[model samples]
Target chain A: MTVSIIRFGGSNCDRDAERALEHLGIDAEIVWHEDGLPEETSGIVLPGGFSYGDYLRAGAMAARSPIMADVREAAAAGTPVLGVCNGAQIGCESGLTEGAFTTNESARFQCEHVYLRVERDDTPWTAAYDEGDVIEIPIAHGEGRYEIDDERLAELEDEDRVLFRYCDENGDTGPDVNPNGSKHNIAGVLGDRETVAVLMPHPERVTLPDVGPTDGQGVLRGFEAAENGA
Target chain B: MTAYTATVTVRLKHGVLDPEAETTQQALERLGFELEDLRSADRFEIDIEAESAESAHERASEMAERLLANPTIHDYDVEVDER
Candidate 1:
């Protein structure tokens, strides 16, 4: 199956994402944001980077790009879509999900290996992990905080929409453990169970064992499973 | 033809802190401004050919709500003066 990785003007993770997909033996193509997404691709990935130089808000300008319309269309058609870092910000700004705004409590950019507990394993992005399993990934962003209303947070919890939660190096969830000060320590969330996924951490950056986190293989495997209908 | 000055106070809603205003207030205090109340506001002057001041005020109010202010987090007041 083919995976479409969208590359905006400032996207730096396109090559990383492509490499990860190639390592998993999945045919991946990097589609420019100005150009439309590939029609036959089974999955779409919005890789991380400072799109539009983070002007007028982190993903505000990129969200209004030409490719996002196609991305929204594909998502509505049940095509699995994954957004990482700035991509996650764009997803929220494009109205793909609610309350994806602003910066961390510290109001500064942070980059480090963060432990994330898999809260939902049924989604296309996390199907390889067991519920509550912790994995390590790198996150780099200024506005990585997951913000939502209390009522929506409750709904997300009730629906099991939260896909990952931040934890400490020892995999313990707590106030100081969450690296970016995200609301409820949420690192990632699944839209409509599996159709769309948005995460703050860089799974692509970690997918290679030679360079990054070993646990990143599990995330790539999860997408493979979805492609293979497993 | 008549022109009126409308003062629009676009302040954050309740429970929403205005960092910009707070910073400005601190700067004012440092500048030896002993004013107890220092609230910042924006003003816009609009020129319109209207039948009455009341009608002009109504039009200005509509414009403020529709575009000048984001009602979700800000409230604006429009004042129209007869020229």
Candidate 2:
């Protein structure tokens, strides 16, 4: 069983995701969006980049691509699907997840390390971490802020769909700690099911020890847990 | 078949924060312009040949629904004119 990293046009992080999964001893492959999901696919990752040059909106064009319908089917069939950064935008746009990741509150691109407090530990994405565990991940995007209706946001919070939130080192959540003005500091969220999740941070960027902090390794380890049924 | 031009405009829903518009408003204020408020929207003009105005409106509305507007945050309107 291999994790299929779907590489849409302008997807630059497909290789990074592939290597990160390999480093964790999980077999993975990069699949072009047009070619369709392989028959052996056991998991999916929507890797990030400026798909369609961010025309109209970030991930707007890519999300409407025909392949996303299949991605949605796979996610519904209980396949673990994870989207990062621009992928997060696509996930929301394609209805694989809720809400939208729009322009940053500052209206500028931001690339920085931020702390994310795990909001739930039972999901496949956060299985390796405990609730409230703070992890560092680098987010690089101009449209990383999450926007949703107040009632919907509150419902997601009540439903345990929020996976991570921007927070201080001590896991205190507030506007001051929210780098991009996401509602309630939300940095990541699960779909209707915990197996499907999306986040603005790049777990692949921090998974390798040679690079720096491996706090994100746990996020990637989620693939391992899926394989083990954990 | 009648030739028609359909214009669709998409705007953020009420109460949704628009930072780009806010920044543009601030820039205009810095330039000494007095304005009560500022908002932004995307307009798309599509040309199509259909049997009737209603058909043209339907096609353009579908375009707006499928690609031009995101229902989660955007509300859009379509206007059609015969060419």
Candidate 3:
């Protein structure tokens, strides 16, 4: 099963995602947004970058592109979909996920490695990790802060849709370690289905051994799990 | 049909954190500007041919709803005038 990585104009990380997935033994193809999803698509990856120069808002323009309709349909069909970094922004903007990733609390671009505490281990994305496991991943963005209505956020928590929270190396979550001041330190979240996920941190950035850490391998392995029907 | 201009303004909700605005406010303070508070909004003007000013306003409002503004963190208003 080949994972289709949607590449919109100004998307710069599509190649990185492809290389990372290829390194992990997963077949991946970078599909230009205008070209549409390949008919053989088995999975979807919305890789990161400043789409449309981040005009109007980060991911806003790309989210409205015609290709997204197919992506939404694929997700609804239970196809595994992962959105990373700017992809996470597009996911939220397109209503594929809850909440919006707004301007960082710091009001500037932040590029660094941060710790993420796995909120659960049952979903495909976290199957390789244990609950509360701390993984180091790099985040690069100017607008990655997550925002949602207070009551809706409470409901999201109640539904246990949170996938990961920014935390310390010891797996402790708090505002101190919330790099972007996302609500409740949420670094990632599952869409309506656990099969669909989005996060600001670049798991692919950590998947390769040459990159220093394999902590993100577990996350990318979600595609492998889907391909193998695990 | 009459030509009209629709002005749309989008701003963050009252309670949501606006880091850019906050930073700008800080910068102004550092520059010795006197201001109790500062807020920022994005404004867009669209020229269109519509049946009436009301129709232009309606179309602009719809644009705001669908693309110009996000409901989660922003509030927007649309105004139209005949050109």
Candidate 4:
């Protein structure tokens, strides 16, 4: 029943994820990608980092690693998988989700706290927040812009797969509040199953109460929700 | 078996925003180069032994499809030549 946080080469957030899960009382471990996933893995976190030095595009190399096949099998079996930042890139690159996280509009790395409005509370990742509720989380990346064709974006919206969108403190979503020029201000999305999710913001970064605002604690609690079959 | 070299060129699809290319274009313009537009691409050369050039091309195309290029935002082309 432990969450396995896969740590690929250059993955700096693996330890942070481990500590955050521990702080939440969720059993977790930092599993090296070469070591493979543990048999008891009930949940997975593809922690953020510049895997493979962001070579050939962010998450491109790590997404094609042999272990990702195992992760896909587990996700298909209904195990929860959460990808953050570069992990989000891997999720999309590996087809765990749709769309692409491309270069920022400014073509530069950005590190700042941003507001995200809960688009849906029915999923485990957002069970702690109500639809339309706002949460603060930090985003740090050079290629975090969400891109998809208008037609497909509409389909994803129709399917209600969008989980979060960049917004102002008052929950108003618009281009003015978009930090990286993400299409439609999307900040997070669900995979084929809601249990499989990815987001650009670093929830684990804010999960510790000692750090600052703990608005991200709810996002990290999704692991517990999945364990309880929520 | 014949030895062939397959070249794969991967580029951003038309209409997709390419900030890196834009940045490079701006730099080039600042260097006094007149260009209506500029684009960037990644090229990979693979040498392989195959039954024919067509077979080599097929294999390299598969490589491009599987890893060398991301179809979501990239368009790729493969060319093969006997080495």
Fnat values, candidates in order:
0.00, 0.70, 0.91, 0.61
Give one digit per residue, the lDDT tens place, for model 4 in A107-128: 9999999999999998989999
Model 2 lDDT, residue B77, Cα: 99
Q: Return the lDDT, model 3, position A27.
A: 95
The TM-scores, one per candidate, come to: 0.77, 0.98, 0.98, 0.98
The weakest ten consecutive residues by lDDT in model 4 chain A span A221-230
lDDT of 3 by residue, A40-150 (tens): 999999999999999999999999999999999999998999999999999999999999999999998999999999999989999999998999999999999999999
| lDDT per residue (tens digit) for residues A1-230 in model 2 | 89999998899999999998898888999999899989899999999899999999999999989888889999998889999998999999999999999999999999999999999888778899999999999999999989999899999989989999999999999999999999999999999877899999999999988999988888988877877787
- How does residue B50 of candidate 3 score in lDDT? 98
Per-candidate clash tally:
0, 0, 0, 0
| lDDT over C-alpha atoms for residue A179 of model 4 | 95
Error of 4 at A100 (Å): 1.4
lDDT of 1 by residue, A5-81 (tens): 89988988888889988987878899887778776778888888989898745787788788888888888877778
Which scores better on lDDT, 1 or 2?
2
C-alpha lDDT values of all predictions: 0.76, 0.92, 0.94, 0.95
Deviating ranges (above 4 Å) for candidate 4: none
lDDT of 2 at A176: 97
Error of 1 at A86 (Å): 0.5
- Candidate with better TM-score, 1 vs 3: 3
lDDT string for model 1 (B1-83, tens) is 56655445555455433444666777889998877755555566777767777778888888776555444335577777766
